[model samples]
Target: MRVIDKFKMFSIGPLVPSAFSDGNDPKDKSFGCELFDKSEKNYHQWLDSRPEGSVVYVSFGSLAVLKKEQEIEILRGLLESERPFLWTRRKGEDEGKKKNLEYDDVIIDEKLGLIVPWCSQMEVLCHKSIGCFVTHCGWNSTMESLVSGVPIVGYPQFSDQTTNAKMLEEVWGIGVRAKEVEGIVKREELKRCLGILMENGEKGEEIKRNVKKWRILALGAVKIGGSSHDNLKKFIEGL
Candidate 1:
C-alpha cells in the first residue's frame, strides 16, 4: 500500500504539480496522456449552457458508497438549494435499492440536475460554469478543487478525508464542513453548509478570497520557473 505521507508529498505540497494544475487550458491535451475520456456529450452540453460561476458540482469520489438514507439526504438538500447541479453517481453504487428510492428519478429530471456514472472530474472542475464543489474531501479531490479555485462543501466519510475537511474549513477557510448528527449528515445541515459557502455574505466572501489566493499559488507552483518546477528540474538533473 502507498503510504499516505508519500502520496501527499507527490500529490500536493510544493514538490510536484497538482493533478489539475494545468486544467484551465482545455486545448492543452497533455492530460489525455494519463487520463481517459469518460465524459458524455450531454454532460458537455449541460456545462456549456450553464452561466459562468453558477453550477454546483457534487461527487463523493469513487470509493465512497453512501447508504440509502445518506443519499436521500444529499438529494433532498440539493433539491432544496434550488441550484443547478451536476452530480456523479459512480457505477455499481446504491445497488439493490428500489428504483424510486434510489434518487434516479430526480437525476433523470434534467431541469433539476444531471447525473452520470463517471466523468472526467478535472474537466468538470475546470469548466467556467462550476462555482462550488460538494466533495468527499479525498486528497486528490481536495487538491483539484483548490487548484480550480472553486469553494467547497466538504462531506467527509472516513480516514484522511476528515483531516482534509478540517483543513478545508478551519485551516484554509475556503469551505465548510457539514455537521453530522448521529453519524448522519442531515439535509438541513447539508443545505446550511452549502449556503455558508455559496452565499455572498461576509464568510462566503472571505472563503472566495482565500480560494483565489490558493489558486494563484497552486498554478504558480507548477508553471515554468516556479518552485515546484524548479524542484522537479533539480531532481531530474541529479539523476
Candidate 2:
C-alpha cells in the first residue's frame, strides 16, 4: 500500500494516545540504562518538596547542538527568571568546542535547579511542580505538553519546530515564542518569554487555562469510544 493508504488503515483520529502521568507505569520509574542512580534525586520527590507549579523544565530535544553563546544565554535566562528549574542535557551534546551547551561551567545554586542527562519527559510534564516548559517545540514534546497541561516557552530551532511554535503561540494560545536577536535568543528576551508563561499575569493565566482545556480534550480522546481511541482500534483491526 502507498504511505497514505497505509495510514488510512491506521488510527490517528481526534483522540490522544493515553499519554499522561498517573504514576502507574513502570516506564515512568525507568531511568533508561546505567545512567539512573539512587543517589540522584527523584523528580517526584524533588517536585513535592518545592511549591506546586514552581519549576521550569527545559529540553532542546536530542539532535540540536546549540552554539556556546546561545547556551550561555539560555542558562542566564533560566537563572534570571529566579524560578527553580530542571534542565535535561543529553549525553555528548557538548562534545565539540564549537557546537554545544556547556553545562559543566555554569553554576546554579542548590536552591535554584537540577541538571540531568536525561529524564522521562511525560512524567516530568505531568508533575504538578512543573510551571512551564522551555522547549525547541518538537512535535512529540509539543503534544505531550498540551496533554499534560503545561504551558510552553517556544525556542524553535529549525524545520517543523518553527511551525509548531507558531501554532502554540498564535493558534493554540498555549505559549509564547522567544524573539531572536541576530541568530540568538538573548537572555533578556528569554527571560521576558519565561515571565509571560510563569507569572500570574493575564497572558500567563490565559495560556495556562488554554493548556488545561487542551489537556482535558487530549485525555478524553484516548479513552474508550473516544475519537482517537476508535481510530486506533480501527487501525488495529485492519492490521
Candidate 3:
C-alpha cells in the first residue's frame, strides 16, 4: 500500500500518550533491550557523573546503516566539538562495514565520550546531563527529544527523515540540519551544526527556549486534563 493510503486507513485522532506516557522521567521505565541488563548500570553511572546539561546524546535511531566514512566523519565531528558525548552505534547494523577500519584509532579518547551498541534512548534523553540530541530526524526520536526539552542537531538520511528535519529546523525552530556535500555530511558540517545547537549564542538560546516550550506542551498533552489524555480516554470509552 502507498504511504498515504496506509495513513488514511489508520488515521485516528493522535493517540500519543499511549506511546509516550513516561517521557518526562528517566527512571519511570526501561526503554532499552531487556536482555542487555548490564548496560543499564553503566548508563546510570555515566549519567550520574556528568553535570546537568553537559552531554550530547547521539543516535541514528535503529535502522540507519551509515557507511564507514560517514561514521568516521561523525566521530571526528563530535571529537572536534570537544564536548562529552554518548553515542550509540547499534550492533549488527554496521558489522561488516567496520572490518576495514581501526575502531580504537577512530575513538581515540575514552574520556571524551562513550560509544555503545544499544541504549535506553528515552532514559538518556531525560537525563539531566544531556544537553542536546544529535539525531537522524526519526519521528519517535524527534518527539522524544521534544519531550525531554533537548534541542536537536538533525542529520537526516532519507525518506520522511528529510521532512522531519525540515520540521525541526524550519517549522519548529528547535534544531539545525547539517548540510551534506555529495551525499556525505562532512565533519565540518557536523561540527557546525553541533556548534549552532550547543553554543550559548542567540540562536542556540532561542532553540533551547523553544525546546522547553515543546517539552511543556508534550508533557501537558499526556496529563489528566490535557487534550491527548482526553482524546485517548474518549477513544477507550467508545471502544
Query: lDDT ranking from best to worst?
Result: 1, 3, 2
lDDT of 1 by residue, 1-239 (tens): 56955444433243223443453454432234323335443677889998898788999987888887888888899889888888877744343122322345654356667766567777788788998999999998898788778999998999999999999899988899888888889999988877877778899899999999988888788877767777677666656
| TM-score: model 2 vs. ground truth | 0.81
* TM value for model 1: 0.83
- Model 3 C-alpha lDDT versus the unseen true structure: 0.76
List candidate 1 stretches off by more than 4 Å. Answer: 1-30, 33-41, 91-108
Report lDDT (Cα) of residue 55, candidate 1: 85
Clashes of 3: 0
| TM-scores of the candidates in the order shown | 0.83, 0.81, 0.82
Which regions of candidate 2 are displaced past 4 Å? 1-41, 91-106
- Number of the candidate with higher lDDT, 1 or 2: 1
What does each candidate score in C-alpha RMSD?
A: 5.1, 5.1, 4.9
Give, for candidate 3, the lowest lDDT window spanning 10 residues: 93-102
Please report, in order, the local distance difference test score of every candidate based on alpha carbons: 0.77, 0.75, 0.76
